[model samples]
Target: QLLDIARKYPDFPIVLETVRECLQDVYDVPALTELMRRVAQRRLRVVEVETATPSPFAASLLFGYVGAFMYEGDSPLAERRAAALALDTVLLSELLGRVELRELLDPAVIASTSAQLQHLTEERAARDAEAVADLLRMLGPLTEAEIAARATTDAIGGWLEGLRAAKRALPVTYAGQTWWAAVEDIGLLRDGVGAPVPVGVPAAFTESVDDPLGDLIGRYARTHGPFTTTEMAARFGLGLRVTADVLGRMAVDGRLVRGEFIDDLPGDQWCDAEVLRILRRRSLAALRAQVEPVSTAAYGRFLSSWQHVGSSDSTGIDGLAAVIGQLAGVLIPASALESLVLGQRVRDYQPSMLDELLASGEVMWSGAGQIGGSDGWVALHLAETAPLTLPAPAEIEFTDTHRAIMETLGHGGAYFFRQLTEQASESELKTALWELIWAGWITGDTFAPVRAMLSGPRRSGAPAHRQRQRPPRLSRYSVARPHSRAADPMVSGRWSALPAAEPDSTVRAHFQAELLLNRHGVLTKGAAAAEGVPGGFATLYKVLSAFEDAGRCQRGYFVESLGGAQFAAASTVDRLRSYLDGVDPQRPEYHAVVLAATDPANPYGAALAWPDRAGDADTHRPGRKAGALVALVDGRLVWFLERGGKTLLSFTSDAETQRAAAAALADLVSAGRLPSLLVERINGVAVLDPGVDAERAAVQEALTGAGFARTPRGLRLR
Candidate 1:
């Protein structure tokens, strides 16, 4: 039996519960193990999944599908990239065993690199430092390997070595690896994907007891509020045992308040003191209202204590010079750069380090003696401080998409992004807009719904009502050219629509799914249809199926318009029977169109007849007899009539029971027991079989006397 099942589901992961059930009669663990081995050899691989919750493996599965894994890199960029690809759990024990891809190691990035390039230019003594500065300025921070990949000159290694020897660059370490950047651009070496810029911890922070775990919990509770140990472990990658221990210790320390799990989270949870106070006056009313935890403030606090400890090798003046260079000619508050440059507080980010540059007249400082805070110590390079030159607007190559965008602006109005979505393909519109910006024709930030989605809510302390308003314009590049003329003489600034990139059905489906999920938080076939996309319902289903596989959402059924017909399983007919049996007929949420068998010879038979569906009687039978089924799931229904006389059972039960029920239903239909006849245990009636012959005689006699004509296949309708 195990072998047969394995053969049948070769591509899919085999679950342990299935194996246990199949071999329940076996008493020995060894016997079960051997059977599993044989089944696996037959190409049916079993995956054991361990979980603290039902969907614990889902995150890992999603991570694998996206070609990423946890802790793939120690740096923020690498970790953020990994997390963006995570899932959860199971028949979890079974899933835990079968999942071979569940690990934090990243294969994709590893596979992309062959061998690390060996450095050739030994010791900084032999190379030219000036040459290194030119390369560093153009490419930003780079690893030694990356430097080699981009450099055109041989002994590029020697040049990098020489620059480090001359103290022209700063090498910052992250995730156990070092990256080189010019002194002013050390922050650029740090990835911004994780955590906000580190700042000085307030004096208040020093008063609190400082256990890293305790601090993490306190911050979690404050920002996220009332989280289970499992959630904390998952979020921090601290392991469940460690998280639970820390939570327990923190509770004992009186830094955390323990409480019962809220929502569906398991185990007792801990809440921040501040969060507990807020919860006393407020409650989350629904699952959808539950916000995912954010630890931005906590992370900022953690980094604050460790800021600016490293220095560039050049004279102290060069380190100061590097900071100014990173500012890119923009004025930055002195206090802000204090900790950033020297790992010192705002009051201590001294001007003494700049004395040499001041004496040499290479750097200029404004607002001297203003005291070091928000408005103090503004500095600029003498060359950069000079008035900037404006370049001539030269004619450039324009794609049709570029022309369309210019034409839209040619209307001489600032059109919102939504207004432009209809005019050009999204991808092309974005490309054109940015190209125009780079060309000095316009400026603005592009709207990116996907990127915005990653940051669940705004963090800038905006009001709720304000946050609900459309996203702010990123940058306003939509302003017309100097004279409102296209840089190209052939192009006129007129709103002439042009053909855009061909729509990719796959991409469209994914986008539609995202839009629907973002807008509604739930998915139903009918809702997707109404929302509409490139390939309509067919594309929507494919995308949803893919999401289900990746553990993004759970799949269920929605039966159409049958009030209160929502069921979790897809065996629509069986679900219908189950729902109707327990449902109260008088309930406002219940609606049913029951079609009872009619006795044609009886006067009441003609009156009880169901109307034919909207077509000729020969081709279309009434819905009751036409095998129409409605699927119900979470209060939504999708109704459609079966075609080709085939009933695709959306089973709402276990695999075995579903199969049995389907076979029985088929047998009943083939034996003429259920073309249209249905038995209902209504309030006042007893349904005695009344024997098989009696039922057949009644049906035949009724059919003959009723005006309904028998078709050539010996089936009667109408």
Candidate 2:
């Protein structure tokens, strides 16, 4: 019905009735002010007076009289009074002559006394023109006739010509133009005449006209609103044409009113279309301006408020509450309260719990219309935040070889074996097994049984025989082999020269026995049988005697013991010569060598020390052929040489090997890996033993010269 009424009477005023409680709704201030201005410019009979108050001072300044007293109470009382006096005494009297109080007192006086005000307005305009003329003359040469003529034609043109002429005759030009001079100077032009006399003036100066208070009031009311022309003219003191122009603009915007006019009064009728349109536009603009700034300010506040809330220390509900409070206080529109609270709650919990909250519709935004329980909220359910479980230890994969070995070991129990079934090389297999033991997967003692088994059974009980065994006899064919020549007549009275032919019978036998012991770990039956007989046959006894003399076999309680197969006396001597070839003479190990001699008491030979010790608990004469064995120990080089029984033999160690050994010995001393013993050289042979003081002193002096210090245990290489 309201729409139908509004459409039916578009030009009619809109009147909405509401209860007294709603009457206090204040319209937008800027909207109302713009509407009032528009209405007044339309020259309408719009009267925006203080209907509720008796005095015009109570009226809104935008719509009512702009009198001095109207602005009172806004400024100091004295200032207000001074302004009012100036307006009345100086401005009002000069602009409107002989103004009577009675003329201003009547409401109808504006309509009737408008002509008198108009005449006074013309007189005042004339006086102003005269004053402008006087001002122009003072500045330079200016004529009244020229001004009057220009005023009717092109006043600005005439004025400009006059100004140009004055400037040509004077040193300085006036900064500003007089009233009539301005018009002439701006619009006047001259025709092509004998002296270039003025032809026509521009329309701006020629068409200029005087305006009266009534005309101004009428124009103001028509253009801005429905107001009396007397009011506009009194406010602005404008001429008729200027007021009409203002009226034209207001009328175009539909802000004018039609009716009787009054002085210093607004139009009684207003253009509903223009005022409402302006009010709506201004209201929207104001609302947007106000809302945007508030939103921006609120956003800044929200950020600042919660800046410290999410730091490392804050946790749980307290942190959530702090953030929620900050958001609520800083966001726009009080309606955001629930949204902020719910959002903050959801954000505070762990991500894994989000789905539950979302499914239950525990969080939401409030702006949505017709919101159901969960309709307006955002879903926050998320995946679990816990770390994933890893695969089982048993399922871990290993190499085929490792798998095979582990499988062989069996589950839950252990077994001892000589070999492991693995694809790894021998070295790798050893390493892997060691690693397993270190890792506690296998027992360290497990190797004991396996090592024992691989090494063969231990011997027990005494043998049936009591005498030492004789070496084997060589066949006629073996005796004739050239390779055995070196062993012929083995270790006779003295070291024999190299033979030109195959070895003799005794040499062949000794060589055969050595080969048997090295390869098969057993002596020939003949050799064994020969040892059993106490007094051998001559040939058997001679062969056995030669073997024994050569240190190739020894008399044990049960049987003969073979010596190491790597060296023959000749080869040993050759190795000793090689060691000496490049050995550095300065190193202690260079002068050190090891000597092995047949034990006169035991079946096997023992390592020998020079100048044998007596009464030592660990000392024993392991060999009888002490003079036959001499060697140089040079790192991996082992050199051997033979000397006849009772002959003096020299043995030396490689210098490099001795240095390395000394350094290692020093470390051993520091680590307590070695016993307190001296490392010394006796007769050019390095000896590591607890011995005579002279030997110790000699070794200490050598070590000190080789960058070593004497320690309690031995010589230490620094």
Candidate 3:
């Protein structure tokens, strides 16, 4: 029967061996036969039900999946071994026959036990106590009269009573007669996983305890996680207060920690200091071991879909807030944020959605850094949780101008743009204001300034409420130089210094690291580093490594060739490996789309470097700039458009890839993902030239194939 089961798992030795050993070694064939007989006789009613998740009763089974969840020390096994001797006559006879066993002794251990024995009873005339103990070990369940007759002692009863008092022996009723057995046989009568018997107690702990009771409890705590007073009391036949008092003393001695160590089992619990450390390490290691590695390309695609970019639109304020929250610390150009970034993630995305959030104090925008033609790229964070990502005051290097603005807001409170610019030029005030925003010290209460910045310089008398047409063609120099003025501020919302989240940098680093894991399904040091987190990736690394130790995050080298440490949420690691699998072959091809260069979904220029550009290295490599864009097919970069939107860089010069890239861009415009894109130039030349470079002509053909219309100077998508 066992052979048949083994055959079913021929390639899995562990499973086969475990099953065989469990039935044969752990439980005898007789036990199995009895269980089967009961089923045949209908004595047992078998109940079975399927569940989508494990039941609470499966807690013990979870230990099989994670061995560290349960700590098994020497005591449980040692007690079981002692019990086996009492249960078998042959083992008892073997011990009696071995005179050599008595010779194997540690004097220090014996002396220690003797010292504790003094506390149980007063000293008396010495008797052959060793001989009496040996007799109990070899042939216990001996009555007082019978023991006295064999050892020739008249006072055997008094001696036996002392031994029982010291817990060196226990009384047993055998054949309706009272007899004494050594405490080593206690395992045969133990309740749960076995408790501390004489064999398992070491000499080291004997000195501190007046008796064996403390040793027993200490051994149990060493081998288990946080347990309740009731649990310990029930196991050892003691009252709750007695158990608590003992544990309290142990805690006072710094031997055990008293607190809620287990999450679900709340209330005061006690655990050994060393045991907790091991528990954390083992739990994390087990979980970390469950996830497999994936390629860098797969990781990139995972982020694209994970963040919901270039996919179906998620509608409503909840969806909008979720997208903004995911991109909490990401900085992109003010122009691309609404027209490109939001449009990619939210359905029918409008400026009003963001304005509503800003107005209600649900969301606020902060300056991330200067990039593209954007005076500076901006990021939106949930207003309530913004303090968590904001830099500490000491981390920010403020100029006199920055300090001045901060001082005013710190004392006077949030001010509107007009009020803030009352004493200084709008441009000058903005320079210091945006600097503070990027430093994470200030936020805007309204999205109007961002709307104005994306709309280009304000028209000569256009009202602040007036909506403009098509936001002027972004300049060739929309490498939009600052013009000796401050970068744009999130002007409309009232401005004030951001409050600090936690004064401790380490705590904030941990939260930020956790956020990164959730933001990107998988996080690498490179991704966190690119965010310019305070103290950089190194600071977050310490927190991530600790999380791995605690089993909150799994650390691994998941993405191929993207070197250095990588950490991912346990579930996402699985999703990344099996991304969008089993889709229909007949459906229209998906997974190709255009993304903002600064979009968090685009790992390039951030988590992973932009694919190498062979000859145009000096033509300004692609970056996470506002006006720049890139096309990806199944998460691999295909084509890149420079910030100026004039020069185009093809990662792969192949026709199919170029066409796929163009088709994705055209669909974006057709689906209103982006309003429109007119390509005026390619690789520093006019988008089209009659009889121009044949190579350039192929790009045009790919674009035309993707529904692009040819114009006098370039291609335009409708």
Q: In TM-score terms, which candidate is top?
A: 3
Q: Which segments of candidate 1 are over 4 A away from where they belong?
A: 1-493, 499-501, 556-718
What lDDT score is found at residue 322 in candidate 1?
A: 54
Candidate 1 lDDT score at position 140: 46
Provide C-alpha RMSD values for all models, in order.
38.8, 51.2, 30.9
If the candidates were sorted by their lDDT against the true structure, best first, what order would they fall in? 3, 1, 2
* Model 2 ranges off by over 4 Å: 1-611, 619-692, 712-714
List pairs with backbone clashes in candidate 3.
Answer: 431-486, 445-493, 446-493
Answer with 1 or 3, whichever has the higher TM-score: 3
Candidate 2 local lDDT, 1-718, one digit each (tens): 2243235434534322211112343344454444434443453442333355543433555333553344334332222333332343223435864332222122332332332322223342323344445434332223344334323333444444454454321111121222223333321211100112233434553332343222323332323322444444334434545555665565454444332223444443222233323333433343333222112112212221223311444345454434332222111211112222232233344422322332333321111111222111111111121001100112233566556556666543333332456366744654454334322233221112222322344444357695457558675454454442221111111110111122254543443344323321223333233222222234344554455444544322111122222122222222222222232445333332222232111112221123333432332222233223322233221222222211222222333444443443344235332223243333333334455455334434444554555555444343
Rate residue 528 of model 1 by lDDT.
Answer: 40
- Cα displacement (angstroms), candidate 3, residue 499, comes to 2.4
lDDT value, residue 118 of candidate 2: 25
Better of 1 and 2 by TM-score: 1
- The window of 10 residues in a row where model 1 has the poorest summed lDDT is 596-605
* Candidates 1 and 2 compared by lDDT, better number: 1
Candidate 2's displacement at residue 506, Å, is 24
What TM-score quantifies how close candidate 1 is to the native fold? 0.18
Alpha-carbon lDDT, every model? 0.39, 0.31, 0.64
